[model samples]
Target: MHPFALIVSEPIKIDIWSDIACPWCYIGKRNLEGGISSLGDDAPEVEITYHSFELAPDTPVDFEGSEVDFLAKHKGLPAERVHEMLDHVTGVAANAGLDYHFDTLQHTKTLKAHELLHFAKEQGRQLELAERLFRAYFTEGRHVGRIDELVELASEIGLDTGAAREALESGRFAPAVQADIAQAQAYGINGVPFFVIDGKYGVSGAQPREVFARALTQVADEKAA
Candidate 1:
């Protein structure tokens, strides 16, 4: 064995702070995967952890409106402009192989959804749950803010349904969710789909595949040095 042979002390960690209801976050997730794919055979070992960052923490659990309505009212944009924004993003999501049914999306608060993700993290299925929740909220129009709906999502991912319900009911993982939010704030993150690569590099928004590929290659090279 060569004395100076390169060895990874740890997998390159990508901490992504995002919310389920954010369409761009879903697109960013796909773009990150595309970036990893761009690395091909030389891709570095990577570990991704999704952190909670609620886009609308103050939103009611049972918001009586469509996502477009919420966004239009919240941002004070004309309905036409909001629809245009959503249409542009929907097309972008399609390019990334996601079918975003914004018209059918059930807009609701994501606090309980974040808590469910924390619980899934404890059960070693955070990634699965994160993907499921994103798909559910954006594509399937499922009610993520409700306890019954969350339990169904948990069961769909092979988690213990009763346990998930209990966690939501008892607020068991609420602290963990809040901790993730605090950590994001400490990192000075102000948006979703923000990526922190290897704890030093920060990539914001749904960047191109080449961008993520370069970051991984650069980090891997530095580790070898």
Candidate 2:
């Protein structure tokens, strides 16, 4: 195995292991961006690296229920409670400067989605594709579990659609995706939106902007020491 390199840049590095289908992961991204915005240009340089985590590894490619229904069944919550929870999440998303179209999200597995993410990384458009996938899955009612749909989405992100489709078809990056999952397990991660700063400190969940700001500041300070 190759030796692991520490953050080589002058700026602190934040590695985020998240799933596109996860609502809190999207919120966590906004929170980090918000903290960075508040930190301004002079804020210590920051390198953001995205890793993969699957919230529902065994979910079906063609999930057989509405998102609300799926969540209800999965969590064994009443439909009313599920709706109430979604309403809360929607409000939280709005506060974080995002749109939550929970009703539009398809409840499906995202293994292929992660593979495409790796492909996008090679093309230097992983973040863009990630954002577009989030929007498509969470707000556009798009099915991210299918290769064709993911390829079409890649096209929207200005990625090489043909290459992306071929990669997906050939099951490239499956190991990368699985390696990420294994790393997550090794780190004792049990959920999405897990943020690792400077490869040491970990922050989890969709915390508020202040929380993210503090974490960034702490990591920057520690590195300076």
Best candidate, TM-score-wise? 1
Clashing pairs in 2: none
Index of the highest-lDDT prediction: 1
After superposition, candidate 2 runs with Cα above 4 Å error:
1-9
- What tens-digit string does per-residue lDDT give for candidate 1 at 1-225? 789998546889999999998999999999999999988999989999999999888899989998889999999999999999999999999999999998998889999999999999889999999999999988998999999999999999999999999999999888888999999899888888899999999999998788999999999999878
Candidate 1 residues lying further than 4 Å off, grouped into runs, are 1-8
Model 2 scores a TM of 0.92
lDDT of each: 0.92, 0.88
Collision pairs in model 1: none
To one decimal, what is the Cα RMSD in angstroms of model 1 from the true structure?
1.8
